[model samples]
Target: MNPKASPGHALSIIPREQHTISRKNISKAALRVLYRLNEAGYDAYLVGGAVRDLLLGGHPKDFDVATNATPDEVKKLFRNCRLIGRRFRLAHVVYGNEIIEVATFRGTSDEEGDRHVVDGRIVRDNVWGSIEEDALRRDFRVNAMYYDISDFSVRDYVGGMQDLHNRVLHLIGDPATRYREDPVRMLRAARLAAKLNFRIDPKAAAPFAELGPLLSGVAPARLFDESLKLFLTGHGLKSFQMLEGCGLLKFMFPATARAIRRGDRALCMLIEQGLENTDARISEGKSVTPAFLFAVLLWGEVRDLAHTWMSHGKDGNDAWSRAAAHVVSEQCQRVAIPRRFTIAMEEIWALQPRFEQIQRKKVFRLLAHPRFRAAFDFLLLRGAESQAMEELGRWWAHAQQLPHETLAAALPAQHVGGDVDTGVPAPARKRRRRRKPAGKSGAS
Candidate 1:
């Protein structure tokens, strides 16, 4: 054992044979980093969630190396290295597509002036220390373990291995104090528990509801990044359930939370179905976007507002457009969703009622719209919440496969509404296939 290597902490060392991690399983870029750090005579170890995930028999996509070497020193050691982050100085060792993030062991900053903290959260603590100190500074027990490259053994400074074995997540140090230091840890707790299928230790879970509001004080850009981790990651549905369970979701996404809390089945269906579809697409190595995600997430609120605007006598399209803009403006204050996504999200929302105006020519135009597929999928989710929507979805689905004349005849007695073009046969319009350009899968 490492013998209480850090201050006031228990420790354990599981020999290489006791753990399942192998060099072959680790990304080559990470291995290169560890070996280089070792060659330079600095203490370095594979650390944090990468080690924890490996212990649980999962392949972590990113491998983070924690070392006694300062960020500047680490940057000196690698040509590809770039120093990043003001909150916590880090060294990114880039290798084309792969990036091995290297962080120095952390300690309390010697200077806690505006340079390092704001409103109780650690905003810029670059203070460096021993590996033991680093382990103690980590947020969660399961994430504080280390893998020594030289000896090929696991070091547990916070009973993380035991927590892992028990399928539990426990915050290191005092839960409430730790949560105050970084409110995002509360979100991380939910995300990790859901991702790992683990229960949260009561003490760790206890202060979540009380402290969730601390998240409001965090930087919107950081929250935006964390939002992606919480929702766009493959385990989104489970993550959402955890966030709601822990009473943190409402703080992060008030509108969505309000909708869910009000027992809006249609809203729930939209979120659940969207997450399910996203997860499936990720599994199949397809694509997704944050626009569609926000469209689903904020739909209930925008929809309610649009209905009110319409009831107040505004045109339906104008009401929907106004509602979309208002919702995006409100939401961006909390999460800073980029303009591109908000634009697409608005289009998706605006296209919803248009599905009802399915004249043959209108159908073709809707089909040609960039946001049509996402809007259609949103309609399908609405279908799950009510029979009327279900019939609408079925009609649209069927119309897509029919001949132009057949579709025209199949349309309800309601007149075709578009540019007043009565529509042409399929052979009349020679249009290019609408293939979307390749993008980062799971960007949502």
Candidate 2:
């Protein structure tokens, strides 16, 4: 134990018929894992976020099983089990679309087993211990509770039940020490607080700003996964506000934080509005893309960088391209955005200038672009910065709805003002002087 964590209260167990979480509420695959583990003579319980979410009457996205059985033992019992990870060995029971994560009880990092502590952080930990030790090793009190399959009771060793009822998020031990052990926990603190609409305890939130930089040491790939959970899962706006409040946003996205701090009100509103749109779409079961969301978040900084480059005499297109690349590269160093989304984001930014080119052929070509819808949404968000942009969005909106002939007639040959002149039609092809037809060429 950290010496700061509560020694723990007497275990509270609620029997089968007493709780709202019926076996049917749990995923069948998870139920199978639990039953098998129990049948194999090992303790198995539905644990972590699933238990927390179930108690709060919310449907858990997935289920996890914690057991006294080691990964190898668990693997021996289930033919479908695949052992994964070294930091914490886990057995994943796969059933087509669903996976049940089974983890062995984790022992303390302060002990001398398979755990390794380097510079206050536990870089590797796979030490197995009892259920009580496992509960103590969890980051939050709410996530420490368990749903036992044997007696169909919830096991609460920490004050998770009380904290859940109080609508509070509390760290299990001394926050500073725990935070040092895994700075990503800070991000989790913000995310869970936002997702559950729970207030973080003062003690838990106090060390956030001071420990924000610790996240830099975490894996960029892990941070990318965390980013999705924060922004794409229907509670983006709240999650963003929480990340900003705790000073972790800059660590994750330095360019965005700089833009916000520079009093870019338009950028701020665009981000909030974009998040609002995403949340609404997710709630309505519409598909959302990572490319569009990332474009919205990084546009202001990219635009500013482009402007600086243009002032130094770089061509407008080159400047935009460079800016997009620069910002994306910087962000990638912190969160590994896969190439596909990054490429889409760049296309969305590059198309902004093309929006001003409403010539008949240009308009048709832009409309035919695969990324048109995403770029158009990004353009709409940019409407906050310029009247020309707002008018351009409106024109595109109307044009897309117009009859073909009517749209052709509506073009007046001059209505583009997006910091670029795109209204000039392609130069009329030069007529070749006819030779004397080798003697009688056509008279011009």
Candidate 3:
């Protein structure tokens, strides 16, 4: 492999025999799109993270193709192709469950095509240009490399291969300028660092703290999608630590950061344990839910608020309901968690207090609730709070193992008034006998 100048940039072409990427490892649908584009006489290459992961000896879940063919021109070739997006027009070629995304090479100049910029942000860009320009447009060096399907050669224009070998993430262009164009890149930097176990280049990481607040201006719905990618990808614990180390956590999740800063060690433990369990579940091929994730992330804020309300002489159930509502409403302004997930989160928090009621009826009712299993799992996470909590988790675990009738028989028959936590029931009401008043009145 050697460097050669192409138009305005130096491109390094690594021949097929030199790289480890094999055609058999790539998805069949992606291969079909690449071959079809090549057959049509258009320059097409497997681009972006798919190529990056392939070069790293990993199997990527999604593949994207970049070509000189415009979206409309590409659509003409494939019957399954459909164009989407106005911010950046793209073609989606669907092959059952997999989608091969095809994008036209993006141009640098705004003079030729429709491109809009507001407050240093690119709202819409549909410019067309050469492959060299597109390489310069990519956010990170590691994601800028392209794999040419026609010649089976890997092309590097931004020293991405060297950076990959060093396990360091380097941003393309000026860091401040790139971050201003899209603040979400700041979060992406942290996420990619966590996902790939790569260190960020000092120059690239220098601007994150100062530019962190830019995330507040991004769309909440978009942030919600990004959050899923960060926490549900089997690396949530590391991602969370990276966000805090970068000083970007507060901007993305104010309530969570606030609780941690207030010396809530138990809260921190709970969160870390929850993320660790989530990662384990994903690695084990078990199903995970976004509602459960959001529930864990927001638990600290709700727990603290409910305690405060209860201290102020509010009813226990009312305090819990109010706190859950307040925290969920506040969080939605930042991440826009959907109503369905928020409802489930609230139910999980509400079930916490019910665990203290060990009476027969209350125990059976909680066991029968629709959210019982999720709420029970969440209860185990609270073992970080105290030894008592750990014991309570054990009790529930034991209770679930026993036969339904046996467990019901073991619990107190009636819920008196004392603290069930101590196993001390309040005094039962004494029965009073009726007097024979009618006979006395007749005698008078």
The candidate maximizing lDDT is 3
The alpha-carbon lDDT assigned to residue 28 of candidate 1 equals 92
What tens digits encode model 3's per-residue C-alpha lDDT throughout 1-444? 443333434688889999988999899999999999999999999999998999999999999999999999999999999999999999999999999999999999979898998988899999998888898899998999999989999999888888899999999888999999999999999999999999999999999889989999999999999999999999999999999999999998899999989998988998999999999999999999999998888899999999999999999999999999999999889999999999999999999999877778998899999999999999999988988787778878878888987776667777654432333333455656867776576365
Off by over 4 Å in 1: 1-9, 109-115, 408-444
Question: Per-residue CA lDDT of candidate 1, range 1-444, in tens?
Answer: 345554555678899888999998899999999999999999889998899889999989989999989889999999999999887778999999999999988875556322465656666677776777788889888999999999999999888888899999988788988888888899899999989999999999999778888988878888889988877878888998888888888888898887787888777877988888887887788888878887888989999999999999999989999998888888888899999899988888888888777555677788889788888888888877667567778777776777876766655334443222123222323346876668846457
Q: Provide the lowest-lDDT 10-residue window in model 1.
A: 418-427
**In terms of TM-score, which candidate is strongest?**
3
lDDT of each: 0.83, 0.88, 0.90
Residue 203, model 2, lDDT: 99
Q: After best superposition, candidate 2 residue 366: deviation in angstroms?
A: 0.8
In model 1, the clashing pairs are: none
